[model samples]
Target: MRSSLLRVGVVAGASALVLATMPASLVSASPVTDPPAVDCQSVLAAPTLDAAFDAAAEAADVPSDLLRAVSYMQSRWEGHDGRVSNDGGYGMFNLKSTTTAVPDGAGKGSTDRSPRRTASQLERAAELTGIPASTVRSDDRANVCAAAALTASYAPDLNASTQPQRWTAAIARFGSADTFERQVLTTLREGRARTTSGGETVTLDGDPTVDVAPPSASDPETDCPPDLGCEWIPAGYEKLVPSDPDSTGNYGNHDKADRTGPGGPKLKYIVIHDTETAYDPTIGLVTDPGYLAWNYTIRSSDGHIANHLDPKDVGWHAGNWYVNAHSIGIEHEGWAGSAGWFTEAMYEQSAKLVRHLAHEHDIPLDRAHIIGHDQVPGVTSGATRNVHWDPGPYWDWEHYFDLVQAPIGQSAKNTSSVKAGDVVEVRGGYADNVNTITGCQQASPGSGDCVPGQGTNFVLAYQSPSLEAPLANDPGWKPNGAAGTTYASDISARIQSGHKLVVAEVRDEWLGVWWAGSLVWVHNPATRPVVLRTTAKTVTTTSTTAAPIFGRAYPEPEAYAPYEIPVQSIAPLEYTLGAGQTYAVSDDDVVTDYYYAQSFDGSIPDDRTDVKGELRYYQLWYAHKQVFVKADDVTLLDPGKRAVVPTRLPKITGEAKVGSALTVSNGRWSREVTDFRYTWLVGGRPVAGATGYTFTPRPADAGERVVAVVSVDDPALHPMLAPSLPTAKIQR
Candidate 1:
């Protein structure tokens, strides 16, 4: 194993605290706190969160406002009924066990560092106040008091007379990373107002007098934004087996390959994942040669990033090798299940990183290109069951995308009704999106027994357009044909906030969408809208029979034969697209090719060769994972190619005279062009040989008014005719 993340703080002299091992839930960006098991949102009636902070501050002789600000920065002062975080943290203070944070002889991704372990804030607070650890976990007042004691311990000589500015070092010592300290200081300067889970508004008027320096520039070695606090904690890339080409077995971590140069695979997606383990443990595992590696990991406590692999290299984080070869993987310091809430710092840093990556690689910042680990498709049929689900129900996709400058439903229509064949985007609030999910304990042991209506980003789809109907379960989720359950890991019937789907039906309060080769309904009450109509390009199957979908977009077998490389099969997945049913497509120009990276050191013949093929595939948002279909299998709907009618009628320009030319213009035609056949009429009757723009009137037509009749032929549309006003009588 490699080194853990936490170590004694050199900046915090004589404190000997492990700043990297700080509690994230203690400093969560969102509201934290688990109400008692019965109700997840209930607040304690007695000794309210505010009163506890006040009492704790007085008891520890720390500045009351400073303590409150610290608590506000850690968690929005909410406590889930004492649920433990992934790192075994509990209550509002995010208290945890410091003894188990660091393993002996651990390094910090480099050999220059020494082994160190510092007692956690909860442990130190327990020693100072003589309060039992169990009491601190359950008792909000005690937890607050313990946290205050630890903060005061950092500055022993300080008293009520000390200013908040003087306590900056003390706050710095309490948390690991300069980024976490800056976030706390930012909160102190600007203040904050949040409605707590207990139905009360807490306001911190904030003191502008408090000076807060901007975050330090990101380390030069890491591939991160300058404003972010980044570190270069590289994941292990050593070979465990000699002559083990193809990386089939016995090797740990990622693969090395170029991704940005000419003829190299283009970067397409950025897969988001959550570390099931805590921050320190995540470091240990990623640095271990026996463990899998990703590109980066964001710390929830402060959004401090650890770049594990280069963006151009391949990481084995996503389950599908095809996705792994073409995308960058980022693991968050959180969990797959409902272990705890994510931090604002984590979301902010992750967004900055993603935006930076997207801009650098020319990847779209939409949800389709920026997907979760759950959205990664399996490499083959019957393989999706083992795929992972992280950044689970609690992750706020709507907000995360907003931070990425690509807000969900930003361009959707808020109509009162929708119909079949309409395309829509699923949109909803995140904080109030409390979806009921059972069996949380089964998903992550000790996380909880039930989520009890926590914030979930997705809406469940049903078998029929009715609330009483069963959920729409996919063939991969239920091969035996059972309906999907409201389990934390079960995303079979779920469609997330930004997923664009084709509407198949509309009941009184339900909207049906074509999901996984079937029509499924999701509730869309007017009071709480879940669907926003959008103008998205959709794909329809042309074949009479169902067209098979594929998990990977590999090239034809003949493409590999030219280079003497082994052929990769273009196998079809179980899902298919039937005629007349349309699915939303993400990309129409998906590359149909494969990269043969056969050896760890490029020793094998024809290794590291990228084979491009003539075949093409279109990527579609089919079911849970994005699947591919042959471009020949479905017709891509192009708005530009559709038949269009002119909004304004055609008109004749210039005065009509016996010898003058009268030109007619196709005015205001949109979406299609107009070609007209013109004829000159005399007294409502056609004049022989007068089809030309300029016609010479003879003496026989001097008293008659002439009219120009235009017959228009729009491309792919029926013909129409318009007549010009009667022209001045031909001059004698």
Candidate 2:
């Protein structure tokens, strides 16, 4: 008999706060000049002020003419400082009023406060200019300066090369709703005013020099050398032919100007981009002449690749002149900073396109050269502070690299074999359960459980110059930083020093390494390994004892009851036997229903029955036999020891209603049963449990319930009373 009882306990909630802070690094400045206009009114009237706009633009390190055009577009040079719009925008630059507040003397506040009037605008500005709202609003000069700074954030090289087109994009970020003509005119007017006013002009390497080239006049044809691995094929060009095509290959009313330079160099890099729009919308926009154009548009569904621009001429993508001149841009249909997994088809097609392009161009498929918009270095040291982060963290670089079959080898020089005491560099990405990650989750540890399908949100662990080792922990973690409320440990696991590992290991999984004096891990996917090749060799061997035959013995004698012959055997093993296999054993008798068996590992003979028992409880009539076997040198033919089936206890048949008690007897055992687990089973599953031994008929419990219960003599010593093979009948 055994005792039966249930216990429950109450649970409590706990919380903790940890203080952490890191010094902010200074951002680099741009080399372009500022516009000449001082006030909104003056900027609206100016025209043909390229020189004046150039000077101001130079100060901002943005193209002088482009700045003038954008100023015309936004506020039309008609903005007033005291005036306010419905959206709470103010100032000549229409700076949003919603501003981010600095950490007050009081600890953490209930909400973040900023000068920017609208949350969205402030966020957009912050993203573009890389300037904190707290800094932007502190001074009027900074407000307009930051606005210009944000404009310069676009690819500088692109701006320099495609001044009109790239600058239009940079301004569009600030005034997307405005008409193109209005935007361009406003920027030009503002550019003229700023230049005349002698506003600051940006200089490169501290040198005040300007190289102004005339607008382009002719559209150049694409030319690929025979040896470059690219073939001129017209198969997909038909799909791109616009329905209402004009000379510029555009159908709409937007002005098209050809700025293709004279013979220089063929485009080499194929830059990938996302439209930051829905699929259908992106496709329409890319194909529309009125909107900006790229060389190709990749569909998300079938990964259907479409070509719209010639690879030879520059496409208005990447927002940088330098990049635009040498790169063929491919726009992927998607939204920026949105949560959505790219389809397998899209990845496959994109990989194919990239591989073909890589073969065509002499560019190496490596991170330093083949990078995301975020990785593009600033045009000058000063411009590094302001750059856009497109193709954000969600992109899976590792899987993409694998598709190209780039050589990813464990660096032979890596200290992977280093001992525990030795140091190594372990690196990898920090993705939750499903393996996506981002820069960092600036939250409390454990407060933010990793969301499934979302990429990691943390930075990579780099070796610290002072320490000659990777940081003890990922620097990306700080509760109050851009990531917000996420703890580093909660977001990423640790990798140690002296650990040798490849770069690909860090992107989609939890990666770490033993480095310096400890193991450290970081969430960075951009870092991947270089490509390589390998080969294999062969060796010889031998065998023994005809693979010793296997068998199974059951009804293990040790579990047998008194007077019970528990010997049963199964012949020559049919299946390949290995470790960890298990099987059940039962008696041959169907009516008697009493048997016992034990599970064993390794090989066992079909004739052998291992048994042990006390004389009072059980005994075997066979002559005493002893077998000697080494602890580890034995194999079990039987997958496992057999399972012992208990003998059926006698049933006390009767009928009772609702709460009546019942009793049954077996040999010398007699016990009263109350609330007995009464169930009936027709096939194999359970029916309903009834309180009485005999249940009344009910529609729901009509099916047989296989009732089972364990009886107990003492409250503490509870022994199970095996029920008779489930009796079937109505509850009545």
**Leading candidate by TM-score:** 1
> How do the residues 1-732 of candidate 2 rate in per-residue lDDT, one tens digit apiece?
000100111222110100011013212132212211111111112242333344334444555555444443333332322333212344334555555333231112235443333244444444333344544443233344445544554333343335354344445444431233232433244332322112333221111123222322222332332222222222122213454333223222111122233332334356667656545566567655455666666655334456666554445566544445446676666443433334334555577667766777655564423545543323332233344444544455555666566522234332222211111232233233133333222321211223335543223443322223433431122212222212222221222111122221222322332211112333332234211211111000011111111111122344454433444331222111111111111111111111121111112221112232321111000000000111122222221322111245344444433354545444444445443444544343444563334553344444544333322222211212221222223333
lDDT of 2: 0.34
Error of 2 at 606 (Å): 96
Indicate the worst ten consecutive residues by lDDT in candidate 2: 618-627
lDDT of 1 by residue, 594-652 (tens): 87775666666777788888888989888888889898887888633321212244454
- lDDT, candidate 2, at 198: 21
Number of clashing pairs per prediction, in order: 15, 142
- lDDT of residue 549 for candidate 1: 88
Against the reference, the lDDT scores of all candidates come to 0.69, 0.34
